[model samples]
Target chain A: MPARADATSPWRSVLAPSWSLGRGADPLPTFVWPVASAVLLAAAWSLAAGRFDVTVFPSPLAVAREAMRMAADGTIWEHAGISAARLAAGFAIGGAVAVPVGLAMGLSPFFRRMMEPFTEFFRFIPAIAMVVFALIWFGIGEASKLFLIAYNAFFSIAMATEMGVARVERSRINAVLSLGGSRRDTALLVVLPSVVPYILQGMRIGMGRAFATIVSAEILAANAGLGYLIYSAREFSRMDTVVVAIVALGLLGLAADRAFVAIARRLYRHTLPEEFGP
Target chain B: MIRARFVEMVLPYLLSVAIMLGLWQLAATQVNPLFFPRLETVWRSFWSLASGDLGAQILVSLARILAGFGIASLAAVPIGLLMGTVPAVHRLLGGPVDFFRFIPPIAMIVLAVAWFGASDVAIVFLIGFSTIFIVTINTEAGVLHVVRNRIRAAQMMGAGFWQVFWLVVLPSAIPHALIGMRIAMGAAFSTIVSAEMIAGDYGLGYLLQEARTTLRTGNIFVGIVLLGMLGIMTDRVFRFLIDRFGGEHAGSR
Candidate 1:
């Protein structure tokens, strides 16, 4: 609806002075909004927590205490670091392999057809469902966890790269060829530049998948990681600890995503699209 | 002509499938059959299970996936529309959504088990948690991206707030929401196996959980195959719906 900040609507008028939906400067600036929002959210949270047992629901303060305790003992950092390293390694390997493979798929019909059945089938199999297979193949350790994350990253990146490559104009390739460029030069100089944005986007998405899959892998079978922390907390009925770990996962995921976009912008400033920009 | 067409399309797929199976068969014979089950063994295992509660397990998992995805998509659309149309709603909920959306749904299984127990409702909650934000954000973006000129046109025709919404915004936003739902469906499938494994008693994930304990590699393979089939089937259905209903607005996002 075109709700136009109607003067007759009382709620609109009341909240308008604060949130500044319409225009110009606000009584409450942009910076203060989230801080205020967080306060409101925390207040509501603590109120809800107060009605429930501590074991069932923990207040923000209680969760903070637990987070502080984990931090003090250095367990949270240990888990977070392990998870981060695993995510980095998996994302790197998956991107490195998927790009060239995806390029081949996009460029050559023979390769595309030959790879399609495998890609189409494996793409549907959830990474979480592969933990057992990972265990069976890679054994009981970091290898399985890294494999799961890389498995999750691979399909998304490869698919995006393929799409990007497919979208590259034939005329552009011809133009490169007309300029006496070799096939290698056309691919490296023309196709790769066009595909970089898509690759970066795929990497961002793959990072999210890595983060998502990492927790489950850790939860299922790991000595340490945030997922394991949450899993162990569930065993103890420590809602506070679970809450803290979840928050950590959220922060880390968001930070990694933002960091990815930031780096992509700096490195591929020309090729990176505005979607990657602020 | 028919043979040529078949060679172009059908043969490639057959070749691909054959190559993969041939490689697996080769491994089973060359390596350990315990780890690498023969195709026949896996097929037999799958057949035995398919004759059993496999139908019920598939149905249970399917029901939970649809239920969770449906609820989250439904709830998200209205909220997303509100957020897009109204500033107060957007400002109020934006921070919370930004924070919560990144929390992996697997992380919620613990809280879900604690709160709802290892039950259907818990599994549903986990799925719903995974999908809600994706749909909501997509819906909101759809609304935001709606051409301002269209709203102006509706206003020129003397459409009221509700009329303009029903006429202009909802239609424009729905396809975007559909696209979001499609992506969220991917997330939904990606998370369900874990949700079921963690807290389920009778889904395919639960079956995998059981197989995991016994080292029943054949059963595990069967479960993965079933899940893949389900995934592909749902994807086809979603694509069909998007094409049939959403049309121009669909797939643009």
Candidate 2:
């Protein structure tokens, strides 16, 4: 596939290049449109919020104030930090377990057939729905949250890794074999590198799951995360705080996605073409 | 001796199911029922629920998903077309779309409950929220990917703006729009459970949440297994419909 027009130049703008795809002739710069749009949206939002009681719907300023207060008092860090930790932990556990399983499945048709049923069956069960199961298995501890997030991450990573393994060039594998290289050598040297892009894409998706599950994982659990923050704040109609938490979650998700891509770009150095890769 | 086809194709499925269930049943023998219910007990619970309101509850949730997703598709597709074809609309709405889409639907539950408060509207709104941007963005992508020369060719043949849209533009995007709908529908399905848990008194999500508190592992399994079936069946039906209708263009873009 042809690389995107913007691919040759990285960091052409603050926003990711893909976001600005397919509209090149605009008179305004990229940042101008978003900023202008934000202003327009903020005005509308402010007016709408004023019509409601502030408790029910807060103005953007109110949300900003809440965010600032949370930041100043270190409340935001505590919650965000814990949530990030849980997300990272779940991501690590899921990746560690799924990568090897996916490799096995891709390498051997027998393993794929054996595992396909469970993967297909269980993937349909959304991770949020399993909050109860996680709670039951791990109690109200951190383990429940971790398990729920990790469970969500597991399928995507596994499937992506398996597909990535399938994408390895037949000739490459043949070459390795014809050179009298061992199966382990082909798997480690060739299969592993070729699969990195797919795995990274999977992990990005897994990151999305982790971000989403913050609400489910923190629900009915003890406390101390962004989800808990939202749930707790909602009890008293703390709209500002709720909005704060929601924005934090969105920004966090976006940041996590970009971080994955940036890291992938640095380590793999253009392995991900714009078309197939996320 | 077993036939090669049966051994290779059939055995893995049967064996895997057997092993997974056998291990679960074996482990359940040693654990508290709360942690792990036996397969037989779960089977019985499934029957009990199935014989009762389970079907009706699923229908209720399904109706919400359809209504919500249907409405979302209606609005999103046009807006997406506008974004693709008209630069002004893209500039106006692009930022909000990017910001809103990334905020997962689950995060919206508390606010939805706060605003709509145990109403069907809340659940429907969340379902719509979960899906609208996806459909819109995908539809936009479809439009963007349309070959420019095709539009030029249509114009050269004396096609006007609306004519060109109907003839050249909209048809090409249907497959992508269908793809978006498929994905958004799945998102809608999952969103229903969460929405119902917070807003509705009935539905699989409610049942699951209720069973969680009531400590009915059997009922919980029933909820999960049924949800899986519902998800898979919907996906298959949607794909089949798309393939049947849009066969020529199903995977073109």
Candidate 3:
């Protein structure tokens, strides 16, 4: 296959370039639109909170105060730190296992045929539904939470890796073989580097899935994470705290996504085309 | 050659299943039954539940997913089209949509419960809210990426704006919209389970949560298996529809 064909892997489309903030066009409206929208939403929310009871919908100001209180007591930091740690651990474990297995499946027809059905079957099973099984097997400890997140990340990353490897140009492999390179050398020098962007894209997607899984897992059973914080606060009708936790979760997700994009760009800058840049 | 190909495809799949089951059986014998029920027992539980309320639970969950996905598609398609075609609207809404999309649906469960309580509305809202963004984004991308020459040709033919959109744009966008729907379906299914597990009295998720509380390892397995089956079934149905009606772009992906 042509080398250009290899660049058209579906994962590239999935990792679409981040929205440009207008190249050389006017920047004022680009800046103003988001600010205006945020102000509008906050005003609407404040009005609704004023019209309704604070118990039902806490105002932005109320949530800010609650956030301040939680920050002062370091509650937000403690929960955020724990949640981040869990996400990091789960993502690392899942990505490490998934990439190699996926590569094997893609490289060997026997392994691919042997594993494809099982992977396809399990991929459909949402990680959230596994919460009960996870609880029963791993209990209400950190292991269960980690298992859930890792399970999510594993499938996503594995799928991407497999696809990436499968899409590697035949000519590239032939070229390497013609050069008298061993299989291991071909894999290390040609296959691995070619799939790095795809793997990074997979990890970014997997990170999002892991974060979502950890939230639900913590909400259902845990004692200390942000999900747990939101759930417990909800039980006590602390809408402000619930709102705070939700906002924190959103911010955390955004930060992680941006960080993943940054790292992917840096690692794959030399390899990927400009259009794929973050 | 045909027979060899058939074996090449089917034999390994069957063997994989057998191996997985064999491993499960072996592990079950070594582990506590309370934590890891025998595969046979789990199969039995699945059979029993299949004959009983498992059907109803599955139906309930499916209905919720369909409802949420349907609503999301209805709202998102037009808006996504508008955003894709109209730069002004895209500019106005893009930032907010981008910001909100990062907020995981699971994180909104508490807020959902607060707003709508532990009822069907809350569950449906969670699923719909979670799904709309994905569908919208996909639909927008679909419209944005429609062949510019096609639109120009239609316009040059004296086709009105509406005619160009209806005849050229909508058809071109269907494949991506269908893909978005598929993605939304998966999102809806998963979100519904999380919502139900957290705060519903019925559905497969509720069954799983209930089984967890009762320490019924067999029932938990049954719930999981049913969910997997349902997920596959829905995915297959979407595939069938896309194959039958998705036009030229049906097989593009």
| Per-residue lDDT of candidate 3, residues B1-253 (tens digit) | 9999878888898899899888888888987777678988998988888888888888898888888888988999988887776555666677777677777787888778778888888888888887888788878877777777887787688876567778887887777778778877777777888888889899988998888888888998888877788888888887877777677656533
Can you tell me which runs of candidate 1 are displaced by over 4 Å?
A1-27, A268-278, B249-253
What is the C-alpha interface RMSD of model 3? Answer: 7.6
Candidate 2 chain B, run of 10 with poorest lDDT: B244-253
True contacts kept of each: 0.63, 0.55, 0.59
List, residue by residue over A164-241, the lDDT tens digit for candidate 3: 897788889889999998898889888888887777778777776677788888888889999899889886889899
**The best candidate in terms of TM-score:** 1
Worst 10 residues of 2 chain A by lDDT: A10-19
lDDT value for model 1: 0.84
**Candidate 1 residues B76-138, lDDT tens each?**
999998887776667878879877888898898888887887888989999999899989988
Worst 10 residues of 1 chain B by lDDT: B244-253
Q: What are the DockQ scores of the candidates, in order?
A: 0.59, 0.46, 0.48
What does DockQ come to for candidate 1? Answer: 0.59
Q: How far out, in Å, is residue A151 in model 1? A: 1.1
Q: Which stretches in model 2 have alpha-carbon errors above 4 Å?
A: A1-25, A268-270, A273-278, B245-253
lDDT (0 to 1) per candidate:
0.84, 0.81, 0.80
TM-score of 2: 0.91
Candidate 2 lDDT by residue in tens digits, A1-278: 11123434333222222223443354456688778889999999999888888778899999999999999999888988899899989889988999999999999988899999999888877787888888888878989888988898899899989988998998999999999999998999899998987888888877766676767667556588988898899878898988998898888888888887887788778567453444
Instruction: Locate the minimum summed-lDDT window of 10 residues in model 3 chain B.
Output: B244-253
